[model samples]
Target: MAHEPAVIAALDVARPLVVDLGYGARPDTTVEMAGRLRRVAPDLEMVGLEIDPARVVDPRDGVRFAVGGFEMAGLRPRVVRAFNVLRQYDETEVDAAWSRLRAALSPGGVIVEGTCDEIGRRCTWVLLDVAGPVSLTLCWAPEHSERPSDLAERLPKALIHRNVPGEKIHDLLTLADQCWDIAAPLAPYGPRVRWRHAQDLLRERGVDCVVTRRRMSDNVLTVPWEAVAP
Candidate 1:
């Protein structure tokens, strides 16, 4: 949230309401998200929603717990973080799910929907606004990923099956892996340095990427949705 300008702007609204959809049986992640977002919007409200009523627990640490799903529990929120939810549904159902979530958003709202490994070493998510998906972001621990394309297993449902020959996503990942190999000379400096050099190579090849201001602990790649649209 702190790194994305659109997300920060969404939370800066007069009455910012953020929802952690499908926050699982434990509320630990929601609580952590609340703490992190409070730095950007101290007055922002947070709620953790789960489809299973039994999973919803007592509110704690300023985060309300409730039973809800893609409809957002009838509450219009400014920001929604829905990780590992759609991965359970069929690819054909993804559009409907996204539409339902978009309909429940407040004006200028945004949604971060994605999937990640159990320990979150690799993640891929799509950033969406009222109109539709804006960009796709891939994040991974440098040591956990052999090549940028290795994170392909973590792609969200929408594009998970689209990573095939002739697909834009496939092309992007292939190009990224090629760049990683080309940057092998920098590997002696460490994975982080080599990954940064690989990213530089990506840009040099005319792939538009979101530039980060400071050194990041993980390798991240973000490109506009059009670049990988199926």
Candidate 2:
């Protein structure tokens, strides 16, 4: 749910929405995403693209499938959600993959890429406008930890291996944790309340953050990539 809203939102403005570079083996998740997006953007047409031709399924309805990588999906879509496919890829190759995905967008479209823990409880993703990476989104269940720093454990592929000292991501997450500590008294009010208040403080203090009440309700927070990168 890290970006279910954003995805639905994008589909509202663009047509022939599709998800490229999905995981190789699972059709179930693709099916789920197709239905969810269709519900919000009734005119949407989703195509699940995969590198393995055989893994791609020519599904029965609303959703379609193609055998290809980000490089040549033979499609132009409004949105593409590529999750967990790059954790195994070297960090240096990320930009190229993104370039290819962005190439498939129709004018003002997007490529939402990121990583997530299985079962979808904790996750992080990046939103790539046709131009390039614009924002990084973090999603998790507040029930996992009373402190906001717990999100650091679910870093997306780009920041996952960069959580060491001297890295920007490390600083952002650590500082967030420190702020969470100072706001601990709010914990008595509840994680959601404390999180909301803490996020508000960060914004007032000039943190470049913009989040919806919906995202907050979904237990997510986001920062620009420059704010938290190695």
Candidate 3:
């Protein structure tokens, strides 16, 4: 929800809406996101979309529920957060799914789709605008893992299987572990320090990435798709 402002500003919309796709049977998460987003975009609206009309929760807290899927219920959204919605689909269907979702976005809107472990200790998401996927973001709870490569188990479905040897994702994860090992000394200070050192090592080794100092504090690393695309 913190990214709401940027999305709204980019779209030049006065009231930006966030679509929580495939939110399952519970509307709790949608309601929560709406509350948090309102803090930033006071007029932000939240809509929960589900394929199963029966799964829709009763609307409350300014979060409305609707029956829909990749079609997006005919509403153009500024950001569509489709977390864990594609894990069951074959990887071959990813591109088409992205296309459907992208078609429903307002100009400058984005689709943040990804998979995350239970409790969100580990996660990977792709940020896509109407053009295509822009970047991949890996996020983790600092104390949950020792090396950044440990996030391999949580990669989004699009690249989870590509983590095997001979693949770019494999090489990236391999380098991440190697870099973390080399930055072990920084661990004595804190995971944040060690993580930053590990990220620096990736840059030093020419691994393409977008370094966000503030985001690094949240245990996140956003890398360009070309760097680890399979």
Query: What is the C-alpha local distance difference test score of candidate 1?
Result: 0.92
Local accuracy of candidate 1 as per-residue lDDT tens digits, 57-169: 99899999999999999999999999999988999999999999999999999999999898789989999999999999999998878898998889999999999999999
- Using TM-score as the measure, the top candidate is 1
Best of the two (2, 3) by lDDT: 3
Can you write out model 3's per-residue Cα lDDT over 134-186, one digit (the tens) per residue?
Answer: 78888888888877888888888889989989998899889888988899988
Which is better, 1 or 2, measured by lDDT?
1
Ranking of candidates on lDDT, top first: 1, 3, 2
List lDDT for all candidates, in order: 0.92, 0.73, 0.83
What would the C-alpha RMSD of candidate 2 be, to one decimal place? 2.4
**Ranking of all candidate structures by their TM-score, best first:** 1, 3, 2
Q: Comparing 1 and 3 by lDDT, which wins?
A: 1
Per-candidate TM equals 0.97, 0.88, 0.92
The clash count of every prediction, one per candidate, is 0, 0, 0
Worst 10 residues of 3 by lDDT: 1-10
